[model samples]
Target: MSPGLQLLLHDASGEWSSAQYTFDQIAGLLMRRTTSKAQDETVAVAGLLGVDVARLLNETGQDARMRAFLLQVETVPAAMVLANAPARLSFPGFRWAPRSFGGIEEEFVRSAGVATCTADGLITRRELTILSFPKVFVSNSETSSPDRIYLHLPESGSLYAMPDLRKLGGEGVHEIDAVIIFPSAPETPLVARQPVVVVSTVNAAPGQDAEEPLECVYRFRAYLGNWSDRFRPSQMYPEMFDRPPGEVFITAQRWSRRVMIT
Candidate 1:
């Protein structure tokens, strides 16, 4: 054998310590390196996944491509999702998902919780059990609040939306769906009550119709505050803007049917 190959084999064997790193971790590292050098991400992903590159490239449907990529992801600790800034998913259906864990932003959520990728991973449907409110009036005021933010939502009935945030498109009150998420278990007292609230609004991408079947779906936004009679800034919870959309969703129910991808 050549000297270079011989040296490589020797060094590889010497570094085969499971305590330091498992085979999967090493393989993942190599895959990232290879992907960085490769011109096409799809080709690189397919090669590492042992799938037919030609078939994957030629696949016309976006859903097929998304399914092929998600099927090969490692499911142990719930395949890595929600990459930090500068690293984001660029694929068709996965644009909302992150690419890798970049430094400190990796603490967005505990786990992705076995994502159920469907409709080519573009339209992921996860069951969430949260405190759902029919409507909320979001407004930015210069009043006495800590953050100068005010909000009002009913407990049993729906109310008119007070759209004061300029980013929401219009100036009038529009009805929108809102829900509160508990990052920790229900037993935690510091944040035992609702700390993180998210609202689901219409997909407001410019030049794109709201009813189109194409990419760019609904936006899930996180806010830090509390509500007894009104909304006020909370000191208990951390900043939740960096949390992944998939991680924010939590459910105790299990799927009745199993999907085995072979």
Candidate 2:
């Protein structure tokens, strides 16, 4: 865990009394079951106290004194919501926003002979499997534009690696264990088959004058490997492409935009 989160957990453990008090303050924000009405008053009290009622109740491992304090805190209208309906007091559908590519335009292009390679099939299957796992955007940084992106892939499942073919390398012979295809443009194939190490350079869109400055563009490469693997495709080829978005980040944004329009 990061040092900041570790400190947070440590501080939470150290001040059991204060933490419990905070928890109770959160619980008080819930509505009373008997009245079947919202408890704006409790929420106001919690806000005035500058306590996060939701986080307090979610805290675990507090002492009996803390728990007792929670009971008193629950008397508040906001806290009543927890007393009446604990589940409702739980925060749901809360999530971090996906990082926007902004001026960057992503296009996938399939390489000419990637489909003919034997490893291509395995790579494609692995890509599909990785897509099934949850993804998270860890960080993004760049100058002309965000050139690097980090992602956390889930480790619940495993991925088998293809045999190394670098020793037998030849012109046009498969040098990478995996290949990623991109969406093709009008004259380009929908997929751009890229080796695990190949970095993509984002070129200006066709027909705009060279003198006209282009927006910041970043190209990223996605690699396939076991979740625990230390070498990420993006890290291996930083000079080439940026990084792929996490599966969850991509999915949430896609869903959110769809929902908003609908």
Candidate 3:
């Protein structure tokens, strides 16, 4: 295990009286009991409307991006890969507001009308937990890499790294193995660390669960990359789009592992 990962596990296993749960309890709480009501509705609509999930998504635009993307995918959080792409590029459907990653998180909390969520309530709002230099990778293959991308926060003048493959040999190169520390987290902020970058999110429709509570089957991780222009994808790569969402999500889950403890 990388020191960073070990540090995060140590932090996670620390004895904080607040926002803590046993691994089993965490599993129990996160486990799905019945099918999601939203999923049920989507399937029903797709059947009655005589359109497949993919078709419905293609026909629609930003207004329904989140739901539509989730419906069409054949996998889990991996669906967020495509769903997150638009946001990564600052696309309208996913951008928190008018081409930005900030404030979108607060939108979810307010829309949910939740002052606090979960038992301990540290999860004040739904925000994309940005992971830079991610470690403790788990996936089907030993060489698998989580799509740990990054974003630049012009407002704060921060340069975030998304475990950038483009910067494998850069100077002052930092690799965080076991732990992730978020210095600027809003709800439950961890001590901020340097080599920090910016924001990322699920970048889906806003105020989704405004009516009632929701079962958060998946949490999206967005990386507002802060790499120099040279060390970045010259253009969005088509190859990255072809892989299974589940596989990508498995990698992402591990990448986001440390941050999700809250």
TM-scores of the models, in the order given: 0.39, 0.15, 0.22
- On TM-score, the leading prediction is 1
lDDT, candidate 2, 1-262, per-residue tens? 1112211123644643322244323333322322222232232334334434454344442222233223333322210110111111111110000011111132112222111111111011111101221222222322111122222332322222211222212122221111222223335422222222211112323233534322211112333233325444443332432434321111100000000000
State the displacement of the C-alpha of residue 108, model 2, in Å, after optimal TM-score superposition.
17
Q: Show where candidate 1 strays beyond 4 Å.
A: 1-39, 45-52, 59-68, 71-95, 99-104, 120-127, 135-176, 180-217, 226-262
Q: Report the error of model 1 at residue 70, Å.
A: 3.2
Residue-level lDDT of model 1, residues 1-262, one tens digit each, is 1112211123555653213333234334533242342224444434443445665566544444444545455232222232222333445444434333222133333322344444344331222223333333433322311221223333322112122233321223333343324234435412313233233434322234423322222222334333332323231122522323211211111111111111
Local accuracy of candidate 3 as per-residue lDDT tens digits, 133-247: 2232322232454434333333333434444332321222222232223334245442222222222222222345433322221212323333344333332233432333322
Clashes (N, CA, C under 3 Å) per candidate: 3, 28, 16
Candidates' C-alpha lDDT: 0.32, 0.23, 0.29
lDDT of 1 at 246: 18
- Candidate 3 regions exceeding 4 Å error are 1-117, 120-122, 125-141, 144-161, 164-207, 210-225, 231-262
Better of 1 and 3 by TM-score: 1
Native-to-model Cα distance after best TM-score fit, residue 164 in candidate 3, in Å: 9.7
Alpha-carbon deviation at 188 in model 1, angstroms = 4.5
**Residue 161, model 3: Cα distance from true site in angstroms:** 4.2
Whichever of 2 and 3 has more TM-score, that candidate is 3
